[model samples]
Target: MTATNVETTRVVRTSWLPLIVVVLTQIQASFAVNALTVSMAGITTDLDTPATSVGTAITAGTFGMAAFILLGAKIGSRFGTRGVFQIAVVIHGLAMLGVALSVSPTMLFIAQASSGAVIALIAPALTVFIATNYHGEQQGKAIGLLAAAIPAAGVLALLLAGWFANTIGWRWSFVLMVGLALINLLLSFRLKRVPAQPGLSIDWAGAILAAIAVILLSFGFSGLATWGVVLATPQAPFEVLGISPAPILIIAGLIVGQAFFMWLRRRAHEGLPRIFDLRVLATGSERAVTACMATMLFVGTAANFLIPLYIQVVQGRSSIETSFAIIPYTLSIFLSSTFVAYLYGRFAPRVLATAGFVVVASALTLLAFTVRGEWSQAFVVAGLILLGLGQGAIVALVFNTLLSAAPKQLAGDVGAWRGLVHNLSGSVGIAVASAFAVGILASSIATSAAEHPEISDELIAQVNLDEVNFITNEALAELLATRASGPELDAAIAVNAEARLHALKISLLSLAAISLLAIVPATRMPRQRAGDLPEKLEPDDDDLIDPVDEQEALG
Candidate 1:
């Protein structure tokens, strides 16, 4: 049988069940991350660690995924997609179980990292499954559903995990994930099995380079707050020639990252198997789509992290309140992601993307100016809704553009690239936001205290201002109660309050600036509507054989 006939037969046999399974897997992975965010207060209290520790755990999971996702795509190609996906599902469930049983910060980080590494196997396989089982409009809709699954998972995690944390315990959230993972595994039997490429060779050297680069970057950024941005701090584990190791690590990561790309280019020149296909990003439009994607995710994830940190940690609110506060935002993301496909035919991707970034920047600016200490302000809700609408639209649009730009054979590469950027940008976003906010807070507190008459210079000297971090008003009060009283205590509390709010405003404004800059990339996107573009076909599309045809040939 001809390859065209084989493709036709496969499309004819496609079912929505596979899409459902894929979406569920996405939810399962996303829920783990979101649950950690919601349960931050509980985890910090239970583990006797600071909130930054929990943030570090979250970064670890994303970092692990970003580090290995390229290798994972190749692994999916070498082994059967179905088999690898099934095993990944089961392993992820075990990881979730480990999270539920974790007794320390180290244990939590290890468990989350394991879950993330396993997700590397599942993410690319999902895209390959859609490519093999669906065609044309169905494929588009499937992609939309898959993109929507992230925010949809966020909504579920906020509600369910919040309730679990408030009532039973935070650990129950991952226990629930374990149950959901089993259900996802059971549903996997219904998905179409895509044949593996036995001839595909693994690029172990390239994988090592990529992994080391990502790890260095993740740890470096995450440590900036504790280790000092530019100078060495007392909290730093070690100094490099009187300089903070954080910036040094970041520089090393960049150099290693450049080496990894150079290695890939050399491999491409030699016609050797590369870790990732450079062709996926060969065009200007494709590179623009990637830039836009990374920017939106960086801004969105930073906002997401900052909001919860303020609500639960700084404000000392319950998980349930934090969940309810962001309902409008998460719902907007779900709605926009699900329905943005309809807008594709009416507007060019560039128009939609530009408008999306504008909305996001405007929303962030609104948030910067309007947010006080209160989470219930009408403007705050409006800002969140607008932010979600813009973020969701841009996310869906970019993913659709990316998938359409590549041929079916490179589906795994596309998926891996998308996953790498999505998680890496997100991890960096959270790390940078945390570091920036804390850095600002420390500086603001010192300045405010020095200006206050009641807060004497001796009092400031007694407390290590350099070690300052985001703390609740109540905690600050308790800490100062023994040394300060009456006017002094009041002054110290006021300084903390004002400094926290100022830090938040500055962070939001910074994010808004990033959102505006993303518009430049959006302008470089394709002017044509995604639906109007023709499908990109591989050069060997006619010569390629499907799994069934190849099996027949072997027989």
Candidate 2:
């Protein structure tokens, strides 16, 4: 090729490099932070905290993230992506450092919640970068690569976190995060500055309301296990499978808050943006995004949340053993996401998406039925693969669809909404699944206890709590090992097995139903190949505004 032609191609290709770095760094940070879940016990032990309290700290981080996601978008829009990206990275670094240095549970919670705020800022800006710099197949591939990196990084991080925690403690885990944020900060410099477009105004009220609604919704959903129902009733008006109303009200309130926000957006002025640009959600493709997010959460939660419970409680596996068992699910997501991105252009998205959901639903249904005493690792691995494949396809496809469907300038908005929905669904899925499983297990325990009066109080005490039921499975098995020789031990083991099987079945059924719901939205995904959309509809200079150069704005 002529030098002139070669140089032109290089320029075009190089334009995407900055965005690529941003995506990679974002994934790295996400993976590192989330890896903490696997080591939550370690964190609580080091800090002298209760497990439930530690979970609350983690949930606070999530609420903070959901609360500020839109604000991050607006910040990115005002300040160039470059500036917002840089600031977010710095804050994230500081937050990690703070967490590492924290001596008390209160400090740790504060630091983690603060870190969530920075994540909200950085995540949206990074996503917007992909939308603006790339178009067509390139854009789809970019989004896919970014999405794929998350699970891959997560698997890698989880594998290493155990060793890291063993060697230096959980505090050191955040130290690693600090280093990652620094790397992200350095790489962020190469990103092109999004020039500020005049006439853009922040909708303060809309942003606040949006943040409040999401925070309330997430809080309410997360509390489902503890609170049971949302409303106070005379006769358990909102009982689910015999559970009572305080928890469900949170879900109801979130729905109502969203409706009010929609009303606000409809009446708001043109220049100011509503929390969610309802117009974006009005599209068929957007429906695909919503479905994809919810589906991924459903599948991922079923695998991540329940498998650990099943293994630790029912199968009596250790955390390290459970993590290894889950490797296939994580790795499958990485592999499938990578493959699907390349294939998205070659095959119809609807076909791939539909097939993906089917795979997930099938695997989950099998899990419901096959969960028995002495199950093979092979069966679990196979199920994990199907789950991963389904989620990988959905995540990659949704990222591509949502960002592409959104206006370029609003990439941050799209990214925030996407993250919010995905994480929220995941949180809700786990909560609901846990509650369902517990309800079933509780019923089993009650029935079995009535029939097996000889069961020791010590054994019954261990069975009452979910954590004890999970981590002490082998211990429980040992306690009942003599059952092979006597009726007393035999009865106890039988009851334990029955309770576990019931829990597993209930959780799996819920997952299967959620995966089916995914089918409805996946069918609405855009059918065209990349680059088919009009250039005017894509992100351009008019969509963004450079942040006012104020020193105070620096995080």
**C-alpha TM-score for every candidate:** 0.93, 0.81
**Residues 69-157, candidate 1, lDDT per residue (tens digit)?**
99888887777788999999999999999999999999998999889888899888887777666676787788888999999999999
* Per-model CA lDDT versus the true structure: 0.85, 0.65
**Could you tell me which 10 consecutive residues in candidate 2 have the lowest summed lDDT?**
546-555
Q: Where does candidate 1 stray beyond 4 Å?
A: 1-12, 527-555
lDDT against true structure, model 1: 0.85
Residue 367's lDDT within candidate 2 is: 71
Task: Report the CA-based lDDT of candidate 2 relative to the real structure.
Answer: 0.65
Tens digits of per-residue lDDT, candidate 2, 315-370, equal: 65444555676787888888888887667557766777788888988888877776
Index of the highest-TM-score prediction: 1
The C-alpha RMSD of each candidate to the native structure, in angstroms, is 5.7, 7.4
